[model samples]
Target: MENIVIIGNGIAGVSAARHIRKLSDKRIIIISAETDYFFSRTALMYVYMGHMKFEHIQPYENWFWEKNRIDLVRGYVTQVNHTEKKLLVDNSRTVAYDKLIIATGSKPNKFGWPGQDLHGVQGLYSKQDLDLLEVHAPNKEVCKRAVIVGGGLIGIELAEMLRSRDIPVTFLVREKSFWDGVLPQGESQMINEHILEHHIDLKLETNLVEIIADENGRAKAVTTDKGETIACNLVGLTAGVSPNIDFLKDSGIALGRGVKVNRFLETNIEDIYAIGDCAEQHEAIGSRRPIEAVWYTGRMMGETVAQTICGNKLEYKPGHWFNSAKFLDIEYQTYGWVFTARSKKESEAHFHWRHPQEKVCVTIAYHNETRQFLGINTFGIRMRHEIFDRWLTESRSVDHVMEFLKDANFDPEFYENYEKDIISKFNSDMGTTLAVKNKSWKRIFKTA
Candidate 1:
């Protein structure tokens, strides 16, 4: 049989392994330093919030890997020797392979701030982070306050987790509005207000200066660029993550900010491929960034690479960007390319609608001249992903999308109906009369 070695036990690496086994009985060995088995990274927050246990996040039982003839190794890959077709495990052990797949994933970014390496200061990414949180901030008595340094998705997740335990969180966002870079101004401001409502000390436009350490070498507080020091037991650096490619620095693989790969996810070296968060496309696909750290994209790249490795030669075509995330109590979903107001193209125009008292809102982007539907962002409203995906593929007009909006919603029985109110507002603003049509399954789930 042929030997196939994969680095990292993330979703991307494991998905590739499972699919490859279905195609061939090749020798597959997956190595990871993070955990013994793959667990859903997104559910890390839930685990911290006590909603689920760590083992519960795992998709398969413990015996699944052994039963499938997949070998698992627990070791940190310190170096990769591509020419020798071997990997340096834990600086001493060497593992050889016929074909290599690099899915090393991402690491939390650190900008070399003072006292960053101190105890009680860490980033929430891996299982180790969760374990450290248990040691450092198990309860409000042990951790009175947590100062999170970034306003991204991870930061919000940490805030919610800590707040669940009655531990106050002080969030620092460099942006004027929370997640304004991705969300439109309307939605961003709504989230800012929502954060405040949660009793979180949301400090907008604030930057972390340094983490103050106690006499015992643990984080005591953090000073900001504003020269103010707020006392806290934990400092969470949730600024963002970067490619965990530090091990490949001297490995001779082509690298930009991440491992450079072609459309097929093939790196510069033959018989070696890269995928998931660490794989940076040579040329960006559509409006997506060269490196997408989203979970679904990673799984897509994994399946795509497995096909090529199995002689099917498939290209990774992640059609129509879509993602969903939760902001405290609100649920947010975005499909296609709904750029922020500042980032909107010259031809783009947005139609925004907000419920009077509730946090529900939706923004529809369309071409100003053509009225062709561009994209949509929904908050506190559940919209069917497949419905928007089909509409984007069909190149439906904005008017058509509005008329059939009822069909696109995921829940029609209980959720508040806003199609009539939204259409009325759109007509008043755009001076065009358009009424919503009754939802039909044929239109929502149309095959064509």
Candidate 2:
């Protein structure tokens, strides 16, 4: 049996290990820098907001490792010696491997604004960062202000969490809209309205020149480029993250946008593969650039890399990239390509479904030309989560969806046929069930 070594024990690393176990009874070892139990980092915001307990974030029980017969090493990886096929650990120990996988992910990027190293300035990237924020959490009654410096999903989520604690949150973004790089203008404005209504202040088209610190090194205020200063006791930076590839740089492994891998996710070096946030994936759409690092994308790449190493020739082709985020009691989702250029001339159909009782709105986006569905964004509704998933996986045209929408009700046979068509196209499963006792689902439509 070959010895397979994987660095980083996050979601991507653990997902790869699970798949590789099914393929081979090999000696698989996972090297994790964090010594704690495997927990969902994405859900930490919920924990911070008191929506869920910290224990609820654990992804697996302690016996999971024993059941899987996997070895876990708690240490930071310092370097990868490609020639020797060994990984250098922080404590100077080296472990050899027949195959190596780098799923180390990325780190928070603080773009060198002055006084960034101040005591109260924080970034929410890992569990450690969450702990740091918890430690520096301001006294609600004494200091009620917090300035969050980013408008991305993570930044916005942090803003909501801060608001839940009754601390007034000010979101300062250099971009003119929320998630401007990913979301369209209309979608951004819709979510922005909901956020503002929830008592959060948004300062768009703004730049943070420097973080002003108090005598004790705590962040006291932020100076803006537009000749303004906002007084806040705490500052949270969510600028962005970059691929963590410092150790692999001189290892002769290819690096373009990230660790360059083919469709099989194999690195330039033999028996070496990269996945998760660190890997530069092949874009199934127009450009082959590294796509945004979403959890599902990382999971897909992890499984694909494992299969390839197990001698399976399966290729990974992502149909569409999607990310879902919720803020101030409203849920928002986005998928596929948000039109960037007018010359692209892509047609999109949108529909807003509102529930007056719940005061919620569900927006759907469809590609008009291909008649194929693209994405959906539902706010203040939970039942429509599956609707968004169907839209993303089915790859249906707008006309097909519009036709189904006209009927509104789907028959049993039609639902099965729709599910079959969707599974065939996306090569993934989206299970749907009917509420009636012993009754089957009549139809499942993909809405974009």
Q: Give the top-scoring candidate (TM-score).
A: 1
Model 2, span 287-347: residue lDDT tens? 3346457788788877887888888877887655556667656765555544432322447
Backbone clash total for model 1 is 0
What TM-score, over all chains together, does every model reach? 0.98, 0.83
List the global CA lDDT of all models.
0.92, 0.72
Per-residue C-alpha lDDT of model 1 across residues 118-178, encoded as one tens digit per residue: 9999999999999999988899999999999999999999999999999999999999999
> Which candidate has the highest lDDT of all?
1
RMSD of each: 1.1, 7.1
lDDT, model 2: 0.72
